[model samples]
Target: MKNYRLERLSSQPIIQTADVQPFIEGYDVLGAFNPAACQFGDEILLLLRVAEAPKAEKGYIAIPIIEEQDGVPTLVVKKFKEPDGDYDPRVVTIDGKVYLTSISYLRIARSRDGVNFTIDAKPFLFPTRMDESYGVEDARITYLDGKYWITYTAVSEHGPGVGLAVTTDFVSVERVGMVLPPPNKDVALFPEKINGNYVLLHRPMVSDIGKPSVWLAESEDGIHWGNHRFLFGGRGLVDTKFEWEGGKIGAGPEPILTDEGWLVCYHGADPTHAYSLALALLDKNDPSIILDRSEAPLLTPELPWEREGFFPNVVFSNGWVRRPDGTIWVYYGAADSGVGLAKLIQE
Candidate 1:
């Protein structure tokens, strides 16, 4: 097998805390990353997961609480004393309850060349429902049947779940409510139905009891899912030696339907929390059957920008676009603080 060429687009964070400060509180810090990509008209669009949190203090940390008021969602700032909570920058845990240190919302960014992008100043999607009180995050966009279907991670006091929404022009969106229940995320829907049923890949995390892995489910309407089957579990007698994805694995961008099969680029991590990207192929007729998979990672944290920031040693993606010339542009978030682009060209 031939390796693809990977190119780095930028070293700095494309969208930063300063860019989002005008819309949110001045004390809020922006950590814009984890974008979902699609081709609209002549431009490449990205739905960015913008994470924001109040300025940190020595004795306490502030968390954003969501509440509904007169059919609108509002954020309430709450402070948790340092002694009561254990913080790891991304999330805070207290008294058996888990709270994200920041609230996330989806924003838009457009690029013509797939490298240079201009981000919209205002948010495209925000926390309006009680389920998304914590915020919407890590969106994966799939354009099918002439509409863009967005599956994202919805965070709340209850836990993380999968939320769906649809849009045609991106100017307006129709909410599709929650599809998968809490303790599950990393969802990516197939662009086309398989055998008259929709297929979806997701990761259902159950803390220490079960090792998180990619799963498959089928639905007739794309909302009500059933026939759940285990697709790829990273740990087993054969997979015991692959430590890179042994800790956890999840689906990334929408799978590319190719002549070989369904091409899926997935993210995996080791027990040390180091993230990497890998490739897999599934049978086109039956997505639940795996055809081939990369034993090692295609991409990892190799640069300074990818090895340092809010969440270090992480290179994660929710979106990618294939050009007409067979070039695949993979846009990913580095260290959970900045966005970067890498191009993969088949040799």
Candidate 2:
């Protein structure tokens, strides 16, 4: 079966980096990306990706990071200034000198109405282990039989890997070590177990050898995962030797079981790496089979705000919530600038 993209969503982007990160010294640029949402009582809760930049470098360059605090994530960064007027940062000491600079942290935000939000003054996740010295980014939220699982990208000099955390309330989070290693990301988990085991969708890429495609793994428990296997691969167009998936594709939000099948929202990019969101439906028992899939994109960069931002032409999400009316509130990162949302209806 073939599917297409959803270009027009009911909800549009309503937020961006309106100011700098409040915690970091001389930091002003701030916004949330990769939002995680859940229903608490009668209100909706969200975990946003708040990004910050430190005092401008001597050359005025900066890097994006999501710092860890206490045990959660928030936006807090370091300010760098060299005594010798040198612009060196401990994160990456170039020009043969090491210096301290501003760091980025991730914070927690709550919303009763789902549109308007209130953020905490401090960070939720601060700099913790050396492995996460850089920070966190792109979190996928999953609520299962009795728990909420968050899978995200943990970054540092060691490289970018996937991390997991489970929580009942949004406040306290139990940290799980890196699940997938460097050069790996885009993790989405099934809400419930399949045959008494957990299911995961992730992407593993290689610049030279293996193409970036969707991979699947199952675990008895959410923490430890094994049975690593490749689930799907891309195909090239007519007269091409490659697959059709263009660049690659990965799981979208947590797979939702419907009468149609196990629907998974996924991201796919072209050879140029122009990213967009797509959809795929798999069999309930045997998720390996592609029941119905999108031939095009579900969402893309079209609006002014979505087209122009920190990182131009990008829409990435790991979290979404379904209201009683069957309306889907999608929390996502736009242009890599800040977090935003859109409304979706499965017709």
Candidate with maximal lDDT? 1
lDDT digits (tens) for residues 158-241 of candidate 2: 667888878777678888778888877888999888889999998876786777788888998777788888877665443253
Report how far residue 22 has shifted in candidate 1, in Å.
4.8
- In model 2, where do residues sit more than 4 Å from their true spots? 1-12, 19-21, 60-105, 236-245
Q: What are the per-residue Cα lDDT tens digits for candidate 1 across 1-347?
A: 13544566666656554555435764565677899999999999999888877777888878886877777778877887886545476677877788887888899988888777788878888888999988899999999888999999998988899999999999999999999999899999999999999999999987757788899999989999999998987753255668888877899999998888998889989888889888888999999889888767788898887898888899898899988787788999888888888876556
Clashes of each: 0, 40
TM-score of 1: 0.93
State TM-scores per candidate.
Answer: 0.93, 0.82
lDDT of each: 0.85, 0.68
